[model samples]
Target: MSDTPDTPPDGFEFVVTGSGVELAVKRSGEGPAVLLIGGLGMPSVTWDISGLPGSLVDAGFEVITYNARGVSPSSAPDAPYSVADLADDAAALLDHFEVGPTIVIGYSMGCYTAQSLLRSRRELVQALVLFAGLQPSPISAMVGEMELGLIDRYGEVPREVLVFEQLLTTLHHPLLQDPATVTGWQQVLSAGYDSLWTAPEGFRGQLTASQQWITSGEPTPEHLAAIDVPTLVLAFEHDLFFPPDLCAATARQIAGAEFAQIDGVGHGGIFTGPGDSAARITEFCRARRGL
Candidate 1:
């Protein structure tokens, strides 16, 4: 799976994840359940684009991927959904599918949700993988200042474009250059925009909630300590958002957790592109689980 778009398997479905939001979900393979919690604004289809969930499925684990609330298809409720609420949605997804003791893989925002999930639903996750992850960053204040500056410059130009363009600039690690990676991300944002445009009010509400969540520097040290499951934290050396030292500190906080820094790759490369990232993740999981 070279991050090239492939023919999607036919098992994709939709179900209501808490807050009455209908979430798009895809499941495949037939072994232990491996839940893939994606970053903010991820559509189920993006998993296919990135070749992540598919590779994990090919590796003999039952893979589950879904859009988080306020993304695509998922209910962007009128009110804000707290981090715990997001984690509960994950637990509900697993419970609805009768999948337990799941191996939870959290990427980016998914990493934050996964940490929250560990505290909220400990029994559901048997193992944890934090890839290109971050704890609540101190830079939230800086980000808020930037957002304000943007607002001052470009007054009220629909949040959809604001967010989409902002993501285009900040989310992808390389920033600009790789045509394929950028195109793939565009496709994802297009899908998300289409989904959001269907209910603009919902989209607006979700966006506001998300901004609040991003700026809220909630302390989660206790939750980090409460993570008793076997954990692997893969820190990307070039990730601008999540510094390696911070990730190492996060790994250190979790008793007996393993942390490794994948050199020369940026944040997006941790999951997308033809990097050695997936192999490293697969190897770690197999060795730790003795497969």
Candidate 2:
């Protein structure tokens, strides 16, 4: 809700990447590592804003969170990077910090990257907290549905303004909250939208890349099922993006994975608001680690 990204309770800082990108990395508390990977179009600082990382820190886990590539402080390399590449970045971050057997907490697009980590580097990830992450099959159709819904809602408008408004509307869903909180979230999202629009060409490029990937449907349940680590799939009951049905389906596909539906929340609710979902996440990780 604050205009600026929330400050860390324990004061964390940047960690430089091999490619000269100084990814913002924050750490608090001390114990087995629990890495928090954020959703799309948000800085690493959002975790602080939501008080998620700090809560985990307070609970005595070595919590690590960071901005993903091409988002703010993280380097936006010219070369094309897929979800797999983003997963590699996660591994690189762990390697840089000399941490392993991590419990990964991924939300939204970060969920895709988290699965990539499990698929690519299974040994590095001990457990997973998949918040609003589901298999990619249903996701493609969902996007189309949103575009159509926007068309119906807005009737028609200039492509540019429509895209902008659509961006704003799409950014918040599944979690209806207090008007004040909604306003605050709008401010943060607006700031992010400004950043997203600043590099129009780059933004479009990324969008196109994402669209191609989503439509390709190459990353299916079969691909995700390759991951053999312990996983907890957290779904919000009213999430418009990744609904509880999809999350449960994802969990069912994974062998021995646990699934829990978070009530009275939306897609992004786990990270923000009262943070009841975040507490559940910490408990899940702690139970898995026997901490």
Candidate 3:
């Protein structure tokens, strides 16, 4: 069952089945493939909104973005899935496209999925870039617990409110200090809230997977040390969740991995703020490809 269309504009958009779920996948541009793995509960459109996808496309690399199973437009399988399950879904997309070893970029929870991909299907990866990525730690787990607890306690809080709260906490302090910027983000959140929150099962399934992954005790330092691909780890200086120090520690786990910190941004900067993250990613990939 081939999913490719006779004429796909720029690249392609189709559904691929993996791990007993259908994943919505889109590919664009014309150079080497670059797979983008988004954070937990993030839809593929977030990549477009963040300018990462368009930036990469302009930089001469084929960009691939997909809604992970349980994300909107993607099928939500039964519960009790792990980060490994998400990784498996990623691998299935790569195989479906016959993508060779390519650049893989993971953000936030997507970092966990990316690591799992490297461990399970190392041959599919040529290089790796981790943005605001972290290995699960006690502190991180506690934060996750607190966030989930709030959701459970509120019972029926507005999605926009939840998103706004997240933005306030994860966006750089400077961004928040600017009323216009903050308002812009609020508008974005308000516009997307319905699409994001309408699919309750999608959110629940991904949340369960995140909780399970955080508590799974996998991706230890030993597992991280096993990744042999050229890797770059980017940490945001003002990130509250994955502090720069811990992100650097994660970088150290990968042999020969390059680590850098994006100053004046928080955990959400890579996606929301005006930062050089996209340029850095383009440079890294170009250097690796000898472009």
Which candidate number has the best TM-score? 3
Q: Kindly report which residue pairs in candidate 1 clash with one another.
A: 21-75
By lDDT, the best candidate is: 3
Clash number by candidate, in order: 1, 1, 0
Q: Deviation in angstroms for 192 in model 3?
A: 1.9
Residues 76-190 of candidate 1 have per-residue lDDT tens digits of: 5654446677788888899899976788888866777787787888888888888776653555345545554555576433556655554543444555567776667677655
Scanning candidate 2 in windows of ten residues, the lowest lDDT window is 1-10
Model 3 score (lDDT): 0.76
What is the Cα-based lDDT of residue 134 in candidate 2?
Answer: 68
Pairwise TM-score winner, candidates 1 and 3: 3
Q: Which ten residues in a row have the lowest lDDT in candidate 1?
A: 1-10
Report the C-alpha displacement of residue 73, candidate 1, in angstroms: 1.8
List candidate 3 stretches off by more than 4 Å: 1-12, 136-139, 150-161, 178-184
Error of 2 at 29 (Å): 1.6
For model 3 the TM-score comes to 0.85
Pairing residues by index, what is the TM-score of model 1?
0.77
lDDT of all the models against the reference?
0.65, 0.65, 0.76
